[model samples]
Target: MKQFTSIAALTGLISLANAHGFVTSPTARMPGDAMASACGQQVEVNQQSDNYGNIQGELQVASGQSDYSASECDIWLCKGYKFADNKDNVYSYTAGQTVDFTVDIRAPHTGVANVSVVETSSNSVIGSPLISWSVYASTATGVTANETDFSVTMPDDLGSKCSTAGDCVLQWYWYAESIDQTYESCVDFTLGGSGSSSGSGSGSSSSSSSSSSSSTAKAETTPAAVETTSAAVETTAAAAETTTAAPVETTPAAPVQYATTTFATQARQSAEPSVEVQTASAVETTGSSVVSTKPIPTDGTAQEKLNFVESILKYLAN
Candidate 1:
């Protein structure tokens, strides 16, 4: 009986090791009723059991389930987590805001990883990945600190594409080729000040608040000028209203986020378009591992290596 207990414990450890990683902070979407309806009950159950389980593991369960709908499941995207189920957990962010991410990696698997804003309707990346690592969670080097804790700045040029909660997601994608496992976690978000109407409204509110504050201060300074100031304030308010009423037209090109590690999209070539990374002196390829042209010191801790790589990538981007 003691021998049998030992075997059971070993089996449980192996089961735990089979699954790998998931985003822990910013409240990533989890499998739910909506996901069950789309990806089938078995697939949903699989994820519910181990949220860190990869896409390949979910697919293995999906293959035998008759309820799994390929189109509806979208297994390759966000590990098939549905926006409908995650509606209550959407994040509201302004353009150029910085979002910090924390991932819990149960086990290390050498992979390529990136975080990007994805358009849910079409399942395409909105410009480029906010952060990327070509050699991520390497077995040789083990998992690095930055690999689990990182921050990304939201792009200002998303326009109105991500203005709605369900329209887009900040997705973290990791593909481990050695194990043929893909793990994804999505953070539903809406980019504020992107829509013309909403932007104009916010501008108007800010202007009105500033005008009110200024008028109050002026009134406090000179009681005699109260009447004259009120008249001037009315005129200013009228002008501000007129200015805000007119439609604001803006046509700005989307900007790309540069990282030391090239964004790997090759594993997703069939689903996404090729992304190009160019430096002042050299050009890097997408969907594959990127190596720095300069010699990097190999004599440092994992954190130092990450810092050095970032410095090199910044130099190259500039």
Candidate 2:
């Protein structure tokens, strides 16, 4: 039972470390996904990503050997791990067409991906790979999820290489920012259609005319002509910082309590309608000493004086 528990714990840890992800679009002979149509053999994934390992920095700039090291081919992702059948033109793409590069994410991470095309003849990535055209380059800012999609317009210039080389390779290198890890994928394919031809590869004369006009306009407006003087900039900055601040901390004086006997005085005055009663400021006590300093009525009958005393007392209590 103890041995069984240890084995189970080890298995759980392996499962966590083996969390994987890869490009699921442009169909690059992924594991378990049938590749008999494009590849030579059946590709299987023992680990989520097979022997493909982690790498650091931008793929185009990063220097090191991955699990799929280049003893076989740097352009070919997964190196010797992939099947022997993957060395052929899998699909063809038209130049200048907007393509969506999609990736399946199980173990989502943060990073950017660079998708580019290169000549398969060289199969070399040192210095600069034979990526005749850099299709798209961008950072993965908000990418964390089930699928990451990058819409990139393919470059029209194949630079006379594809004219004779026949086919090219598309490679997507995904590098994780938080860790020293990188995901690499490649698809063997050919370039054809509208933009692939050398004749049409160069843009139309109208585009070139527009580009020339833009350059001339830029040349006309030199930096010295539009520069702001340092003294004027300093003055503006000084004016912005010249702020008059209101007091932040203030101490309001505590309120004073003045002795008020308006209600008692009013009650005393009201009692005078029936009997002559003194005001609150000048009052005299009568009958019981317990009701000290009360405004009692003078020259009043016993019942009238008693009523006046009760009325004043009620107001005074309130």
Candidate 3:
């Protein structure tokens, strides 16, 4: 009975072991370690516990190796360990986990003639993953062999998942060509806590604001001038009518006959001296020089009568 009880206990232990499948904790195992390692690269891993209650690790290459180094193995081991421990769902790793990531570079619709990149987040860029970035000529298959990768330290606030919190996104922008003009393409990497995705920074122009203000100023300044011009036109029209009326009243009614008559009367008065001589001669010849002499001749001509009377007065005084 004792033996049977011991066997039962052993059986229970076996069942429990079977239920919790055995997992090989990631360690520096020779060939496998080498295979898992990456040189001058960036890697990511998603780790989850399987139905057999064993931790399973799957490696993903976030960036590719441009050069080989000892640090790459270290990165691979660290990534594997993290997966085994199930510490985080998203992991960012540098160096190790030998895998190649292909990045296809495209010119903007405007296009780019050349491009350069810099790390806004990492400082160990020299001889690191940040320096290993590859450049490539764009093609139908992908970017040409000019592309490379480099190492960089991940920011503390990026790549973590969250329900309400947010993350810092690492951005990479490259200039390329389209139709011989330069254009830009950008990619973003998120870090430290996640929710819904968000974007980065932007730039703006004050020219639009200036244009709006100028339009408003023009509208404000023009209306008064237009009104003044209209008022001036009205005033000029009224003045022109008054001027036209005055000229009509002053200019049209005098006669040519009256002017000629006045001229003839003045001429006769000027000839009075000659008329006196003629009257004196007549008086001498007729001896009938009645001192008044019929007041000289007045045949219904007032101008001639006045002249004859003046001549008689002159003769009598002499």
Number of the top lDDT candidate: 1
**lDDT (10s digit) by residue, model 2, range 198-254:** 221112111122232222211212111233334432324443342223213348657
Q: Best-fitting candidate, measured by TM-score?
A: 1
- lDDT by residue (1-318, candidate 1, tens digit) is 896456345434443555788997767888899999999976777777678888877776677778999999998889999988876566666565566788888878888999999999999999989999999999999999999988787788988897666889889999987788888999877666422221211111111222322222111121111222233223244432422122334676474332221222211112344333333133222312333444555887889778767766766564
TM-score of each: 0.57, 0.38, 0.17
Rank by TM-score, descending? 1, 2, 3
State the lDDT at 266 in candidate 2: 16
Give the alpha-carbon lDDT of every model: 0.68, 0.40, 0.27
Report the C-alpha lDDT of model 3 over 1-318, residue by residue, as the tens digit.
896456345434433332221112111111222323442222221111111111111221222334334444333222222222221121122111111222333221221222122122231111222223233234443443534232223322322231111121112223233222121111111222222111111101111212222222112121112222333223244432422111122465563222123123311112232211234545444443334325456466888778777767666765
Poorest stretch of ten by lDDT in candidate 3: 21-30
Judged by lDDT relative to the true structure, which candidate is superior, 1 or 3?
1
Q: Whole-model lDDT, candidate 2?
A: 0.40
lDDT of 1 at 236: 42
At residue 3, give the lDDT of candidate 1: 61
